[model samples]
Target: MSLKFHRDKLSPLNIWPGFVDALTALVMVLVFVVLVFVIAQYILGTELNGRNKAVDELNQEMNRLSALLMRAKQDINQLDAEKTQLSEQVVTFEETIESLQSQNMTLSTKIESLTSDKANAAKAKMSLEEKMAYLQSQIQELMSQLKLKAIAIDQHKSNNQVLEEEVASLTKKLKSALNSEAIKLANYKSEFFGRLKEALADQTDIIVVGDRFMFQSEVLFDSASAELEDNGKEQLKILAQTLKKISKSIPADLNWILRVDGHTDKRPIHTKQFNSNWELSAARAISVVNFLAQQGIPTKRLAAAGFGEFQPLDTTDQDGDYNRNRRIELRIDQR
Candidate 1:
């Protein structure tokens, strides 16, 4: 039996030892592969850590950029607000300029109107001055004429007194011839008036009223003055020459007189020279008598009288009537 078992083990089907050796070799190879895989894993972990650090740095840079953008937007908004306020101020300035222009135009028109009115007033004043000058000239002309009439009368009165004495002596011698002489004297008086009228025919201011020669006061005298002017002296000289011729032809016994009567308007006078209209009229008549005496007229043949504000040719209360009421008259009458 022992010999049969030993022979079975030694047979070719006894592969147990060889199988254990192969299994041991396969286990060693698996160990080597596990070591290689552990080394590769360690290298991959190190590379991943470096990539994570780079990503964190990139995220911080992006946040900083976003903060800068927000600041830029805020600045833009502030600028827009300021621009709107400036535009409103510019509009206000334009309105003020327009109002000032309107006011300037209104002032210009007012100045032009005032200038026109001033020119018109100046023209009116010039015209008034011209009219006043004309009126003054007229008054001066009237004044010169009045003075001559007054002077002529006084000269005649002095010559008449000498003639009166001669006539009285002649009358006593011609008593029987008185009636015929009276008739002759009456005829002579008419002839003398006709001759006097002829001598003064060219004078329109002297008017024959009844038996008297009437003259406007203004034609013979200045206002409130008895002084004779050059023109008045010339006129009185002519009258004195004519009267001397008439007196030589007349008979001295007739006792003829040339009555010089002065009249004044109702208007009263109170001046340094004259106290009233009565004094003015009386002075004018006396002035005439004095002038006639100076001209070699007979004093006895001249008579002076004054009527103050009593008799007037014109009755109405008018400026022209007042002028007409003032008069002077020459009349031939018995002394």
Candidate 2:
């Protein structure tokens, strides 16, 4: 017989075994729940660690951006300062130019006034010249009258000797005076000639334009080229040195104006550099003027002019006839 198992049939040892089995299943279910909870916790912890690393990287990027922004701001400030300085310089330059313009205008007005005065003075000079001419005529007339009177007095034979003596004395005085005047003129010519020769002694194309040192059409320049050769420069150097010295000794009344005038042959130069004789002549003049400038002469005092075969000494084209046309005339004038 078996003990009652609460309205169910059972073996003698079945109740205990079933109770143990049910307890074991319940323990297994609890263990599975714990394992699930551990897995979820581990996943959550890993995600939290990854989020923290991302936040740290974002912080570093923000810091880097901040540094670049600061540098850019400093650069902008420097540029703005430079711009302001440049603007100030421009304003100062404009003010200076305006001041110069006003001063120039004042000088122009003074020049106009002086020009009128100079014109009026020129008329007065003409009047003085006329008076001097009249005086010279009167003096000549008085001399003629004196000669006639002397002739009449000498006609008497007794007084002839005395008259002759007086005439001889007058003649000697006139001769002496003429000799003195002639000597003065010769001295002037010699002085000018010496200086011009000294100036042009070293130059090839330059001719000392006086009574001495002969330079004709034959030896002055290249037939076609206005370009002065090495010899030409040498000659120019001597001339420049002489002029520099001569300028120091010129009369105070003279304000010497140095002009380099070029002349060319009648033939045209159709090269790339020059179109006509005028251009070639002009280039030669400029070349001479530039040489003078290089010799320490002021640019303001030097001027260039070209006379293209127009003012020839000889009318006909013959051998050596072009000498007059191919010339570099260094002219000195009181300006």
Candidate 3:
């Protein structure tokens, strides 16, 4: 009974040792598994971090590519707009070119018409010039004929001018000769007047006037009588002597004479010997001329004239005026 109990106990102890070894082996296996798991987790975490970094880099690259695409799209759109503008400008230029071509054709046709007109005008000008040349030739021939006729007229005028000059010269010479005689007569007359003025200086009633000597009617006659007074005869004797002296100095060619002009007042006179004032005036002048002739003065050198109040020294109807008008005027003059 004791041996069996001991054997059972030993068998139980042997079971406990095997069980402990199995537990330890199980613990070591669990530790090795935990270590492997930790290593695996570390490696996995490192690999996951590297992959996440790569993914973030790839995301940034994609964002950059998208921005580039947007810019390219904008450039294409702007290019399209510029192309549209260029097309419009091309259309305008083509239209302008066509208009210019039409104007050029019109100018070409006008230039051709002008050229034809210019040729026709040149032909007409040539014909007109020929007609003008013919007219000029005719005018020249007429001018030559006129010049010949003018020369002939000039020759005739020259001959007539010679005869006219000769006649003019002869007339001039004759006039000069006559003028010389006249000058001599005038000088002698002046000298005769000077002598008479000195001789009759005391006689206030006798006055010299413009180549003539005036004698009052009262000095020569009484009242309306033609008979000369004694004093008048003395005056006539002095005039006769003066005339003779002057005549001796005068040239024979000078036909000088002493004229006695008698004047009467406007009073009417009718008498036995005188019918009117004219007759009385004429008788007075004749009496003076006859008395001078009797005093040895040449009859041809004496003249008598009467004026019945026609030529008056004074025109007023007064006593003094009548006295002045009723006078005898003695003039020495050319016949």
Candidate 4:
């Protein structure tokens, strides 16, 4: 048993060696595997760290690039704004240029018009200068003529003084003769008038005024008529007879004249025969002068005249005033 036990221990010892070898091999293999796992973990960690660093760098790069892009956009926006302002400035410059061009054109036209007007004014000035020279020469000629005329006027003044003296002497003699004749004629006129008053004593229409005899128109003619009535003819005949008697005593060179003046009232008259009171008054005076001529009075010694309403003895607006204004007047005067 002991032997068997010893043998058994020896056999187990052999097996233990084998088991020890196997354990040793397994330990070596496990150690190798652990080493390989540790190496792989280190490598993986390194790789992961490298990858994280790269990612961080890439993120920083992306952030930088985004900032650059934002700046670029801002620059683009600023450039666009500047471009817009430049465009507006360009438009304003263009409008200002157009306005300056229009002003320049207007100034050019005004310059041309002023140039033309200046030329015309120069021509007119030249013409005026020539006319002034001509007028100066004419003034000199007129001055010479005035000197000659002054000399002739002096000579005429001398002659006129002599003639005035002679005329004064003759006028004084003539005035004395005329006064003598006038006195004689006045005496004859008084006698004639006295005789006429006696001959026409029954007639009330005749009146003697200052150096005149007045007869109402009603006593001579009908209303608005120029013809002589029968009573007017008779009265005129008596006047003619008185005048003939007075003429025989008057001097032949007395130069006496009988003036028959016809007057009219303010009333207007319109007829086929007489257009106005002036014409009617003129016709009545002519009729009176013609009747006196037929009564043997010389035509040269008789005168006729017509006075319209312009000459009024009475200016009152009354019937009696109008009647007094309408009359015939007889006056004796020098021819």
Local distance difference test, per candidate? 0.68, 0.62, 0.77, 0.78
Better of 1 and 4 by TM-score: 4
* Candidate number with the higher lDDT (2 or 3): 3
How many clashes does the backbone of model 1 have?
A: 33
lDDT of 3: 0.77
Q: Which of candidates 3 and 4 is the stronger one according to TM-score?
A: 3
Tens digits of per-residue lDDT, candidate 4, 1-335, equal 68988887776333677898989999999999999999987987787577556545655654554555455455546545654554565566556556655655665566567886666655555554565566456556645655564555455455545545554555565556568878988888888888888888888888888778889999999999999999999899999989988997776656899999999999999998988998989899999999999999889889999987778899999999999999999988886
Clashing pairs in 2: 199-239, 202-234, 202-235, 203-235, 217-323
- Among all windows of 10 consecutive residues in model 1, the one with the lowest summed lDDT is 149-158
After best superposition, candidate 1 residue 61: deviation in angstroms? Answer: 99
Report the Cα RMSD per candidate: 75.4, 48.2, 77.1, 71.7
* Model 2 accuracy (lDDT, Cα): 0.62
Q: What TM-score quantifies how close candidate 4 is to the native fold? A: 0.51
Question: What lDDT tens digits, residue by residue, belong to model 3 across residues 1-335?
Answer: 99999898887334888899999999999999999999987987787577556545655654554455455455545545554554555455455445545554554555567886766555554554555565456556545655554555455456545545554555565566568767888899999999998888999899899899999989999988999999999988898888888887675556898999999989888889998888888899999999999999889998999987788888888998998899999988888
The number of residue pairs in model 3 that clash at the backbone is: 0
Task: Give the least accurate 10-residue stretch of model 2, judged by summed lDDT.
Answer: 211-220
**Candidates by lDDT, descending order:** 4, 3, 1, 2
